[model samples]
Target: MPILDPLSFECVSHSDEQTQRLGARFAQAIPPVCVVALQGDLGAGKTHFARGIGMGWGAAQELRSPTFTMLQEHHREPDAGARLYHVDLYRAERAEDVASTGLLELLEDNDGVIVIEWPERAWDQLPPEALRVRFAVTAPSKRNLTFSTQSASAWQTLLKFRKLAFGV
Candidate 1:
């Protein structure tokens, strides 16, 4: 289902820290059993944003991109009772490759946050309720981040983030 109240919000970040701050807001605003689909080119600050998500979500360790290893798992503190699975599909050219990486299984488990970079590679396999976030490099050290959701439930969660991130 489409978002009954289709919403759009934009944030500009001049540094990695600012980008992460926006992501932290997103992490806190989004609900559980949610998928975050990140679409962006290289140097678009996707990883930085994911790092912020880990922090905002109360991860107990440093967050890192799984570009070469393809997957990284971060456990939240006991009080948080959550986890973050960071996945990079930059090398997964085929949907089959994405499947081989056990991403579909991870989504099916739905026990924690899953932040996917280069999500377009597994578009067909992703959930319809995913929060689609797009990133654009506007300058050498600047980025434009946009968040959108397709399903009604996802839209509701996006609205929460909107209020927290933009006070609107």
Candidate 2:
């Protein structure tokens, strides 16, 4: 596959439902073993977006923030072996702390998709191919999302997501 230009695409979500719909389409189109680095402030809708991802990815359990537990694994079929790792690093202050959470081991195992919040805290540890998404609160009911990636597969996934999300 040919690598695409690392151009960013932006979308404005007017409600949590819209954000969830967008995220669902995004997860449905993305490849497995992908890493999505989410950057945004509190109440920026990252968790809501992640819930959509889990739902679209066929997660069997209820999707919730792993704020207290730090990591939550979502799997629809254990026998099928595909998993989704939802990691929150907001409480982790150092890269070592993030590393100690066994994220690297999971990445190496290539068992599923990884969606991380507060990824900037461990920027150095993330794979270079990771897709970067930024969410900004533009209004009380509106959030702006931008997606960018350099990896060929990640870029292709973004294109598919865009097409699916927008029918473009």
Candidate 3:
């Protein structure tokens, strides 16, 4: 994959629902063991977007940021085995702290998926082939999302997934 330019993928949503709408498609299309790094500021709608993914991932429960708790697992919607890991590194003060969380252990091809919020805080812990989703809040109800992939398979999936999300 190329060094992920901002233009490689684009998604603009005017509301949380719109963001989630796009996220729903991604969730449905996603394969297992995906490491997703969600980058954004406070109230950037990362949680809402992940909720959409949880719903599409067949999660049976609600999806929250797990910011304070560090990690939360949402049962796959309407199923089991297939799952989602919602992680927040907002409170982690150091890279070592993030490392001590056993990031390598988490990347071991588990049956579920991993979603990381505040990814900038855990840069070195992320997988090399992870999908990068950067969300920018333009207004109270507007957002711009940029997607990039670090591996060929992830890039291809992102392309196909973007087309499906746009229905074009």
Candidate lDDT scores, in order, read 0.84, 0.83, 0.78
Error in Å for residue 48 of model 1: 0.5
Candidate 3 TM-score versus the reference: 0.89
Question: Which segments of model 1 are wrong by more than 4 Å?
Answer: 1-5, 79-81
Task: Summarize candidate 1's per-residue lDDT along 44-120 as a digit string, tens digits.
Answer: 99989998988898889868889887888788778566668899999998777798777999988888888999999
Could you give candidate 2's per-residue lDDT for residues 1-168 as a string of tens digits? Answer: 122345568888999989988788888888877898889999999988998998888888867889877789888765468889999988888777788777778777767899998888877778878888889999998998988876776777788888888876
Task: Tally clashes: model 2.
Answer: 0
State how far residue 68 of model 3 sits from its true place (Å): 1.2
CA RMSD per model (angstroms): 3.1, 3.3, 2.9
* C-alpha-based local distance difference test score of model 2: 0.83
Q: What are the TM-scores, per candidate, against the unseen true structure? A: 0.91, 0.91, 0.89
Give the worst 10-residue stretch by lDDT in candidate 3.
1-10
